[model samples]
Target: MSTRIEVVAGRRRWTVEQKLAILRDAFGPEGSVGDACKRHAIGSGSIYTWRRQAMSGELGGARPAPLPSFAEVELSAPVPGLPTAGSHIEIELPSGVKLTVDSGVDADALARVVAVLTR
Candidate 1:
């Protein structure tokens, strides 16, 4: 029988700056925790630990902001003969959120903006 051996790497040491950058990327706009973990070659446990440290002011910086969630928005084209690019429609949700959308705006883009604002 033949035996095979594998070489293991030593533990990686990350500086405070590196950790903070990773934390920011994980929680910043358009950031994904999974993606950040993969890019930094770390696990969720480390990310969570660093996040907790940051929140507790142990990481030497302010806590990372939470990622915004998304909601759907529906829009309709502006009525013709308004003498402008498009008409504006204002909506006020029961949650006290206000949205002013141009009827000529793209539905998907408007949806994304509304989603971010609502979050």
Candidate 2:
């Protein structure tokens, strides 16, 4: 003789952002869907569902943008010693070489600014 058991669970819907966030965290370095589910107290099936939804564009219209390539940026310059927008300033190093940089700027802008300042 054998006994049969039945289980019933309700389906809980999550927002698209919420689902994507979970999927991103779930697949982090050294992490898997199973591990993520275990760590976050979610079901493995939920992760699979989210993955499928993301692939099919069923969740939302949102998608990650492709990263820009180096060729996309231009590197022309006024040279490093020049100034712009008051945000950047020029400084002469101990070696008597001038450098220009913004108070807080990104690498691309910093490089351009430095080129202008050094020129």
Model 1 steric clash pairs? none
What does the lDDT read for residue 14 in candidate 1?
90
RMSD of each: 12.0, 12.8
Give the Cα error of residue 30 in candidate 1, in Å. Answer: 0.8
Q: Give the TM-scores of the predictions, in the order they appear.
A: 0.45, 0.38
| lDDT, model 1, position 16 | 91
| Tens-digit per-residue lDDT, 24-66, candidate 1 | 8999998889999999999989999988787656677555344
Q: What is the lDDT of residue 75 in candidate 1?
A: 39
For candidate 2, the per-residue lDDT at 108 reads 76
Runs in model 1 with CA error above 4 Å?
Answer: 1-5, 61-119
